[model samples]
Target: MDYIHLNEMEFYGYHGVFAEETKLGQRFRLTLSLAVDLKQAGETDELKQTVHYGEVYGLCKDVVEGEPKKLLEAVAEQLASRVMEDFPLIKGVRVLLVKPDPPIPGYYKSVAVELTRGIFV
Candidate 1:
């Protein structure tokens, strides 16, 4: 099917395995691809026929900035779960979570995890 994409959503949170990491927190970037049937919305031109992306953005902000998870995988899971729960038209979700900076001693753009959940998976 069809897709609605929300890209490069940024947030700050404490999410890491290290002690300092949990205390200091870091920036996170999230991207969501919502699998949905947009034909109804396109045809009817009704807001309810499609997923409201504004609500989705708030939901992503809450999950990414709310809790401290040791792994990006867990964060991705939570986000995917919520999207499926709150939006009925959303058949599935693809969550891409990025940790812009980590305590790891290396040179890289970032560390990230991608999760696919529900019918879209």
Candidate 2:
């Protein structure tokens, strides 16, 4: 299996369990690993044979910055679902969602959720 990686894509979003978080919004970081067959792209050197990076980035932006979900899991699920549906070449995806600021009283860099979805019809 071949992979296309998009790392450290950042956006502003309202996603958390606290009211302040939903109202104020915060920064979000997404890293995606797309499972695709790049044999054709390598052989033919055609953009059509592989996924378009801009389109995927746009989709991620739309999803992450669009709505306020209570949990990072929901955001990841939605992203994974949309990616597989929109891109035929993508057979699977790894979605890593990072929340740099959480309301929790803890000392840490960030909190995150990662999910993998694949083999969609």
Best by lDDT: 2
lDDT of 2 by residue, 1-121 (tens): 9899999999999988899999999999999999999999999999999999899999999999998999999999999999999999999999999998888997999999999899422
Instruction: Put down candidate 1 lDDT per residue, 1-121, tens digits, no spaces.
Output: 9999999999998888999978988899999999999999999999999999999999999998898898888889999999999999999999999888888898999989988887774
- Relative to the unseen true structure, what is the C-alpha lDDT of residue 61 in candidate 2, on a scale of 0 to 100? 98
Native-to-model Cα distance after best TM-score fit, residue 9 in candidate 1, in Å: 0.4
Task: List where candidate 2 sits over 4 angstroms from the true fold.
Answer: 119-121
* Candidate 1 lDDT score relative to the true structure: 0.91
Pick by TM-score: which candidate is best?
2
Give each model's whole-structure lDDT. Answer: 0.91, 0.94
- As for candidate 2, its clashing pairs are none
- Reference-based TM-score, model 2: 0.96
Clashes of each: 0, 0
lDDT of 1 at 18: 92
| Candidate 1 lDDT trough over 10 residues, lowest sum | 112-121
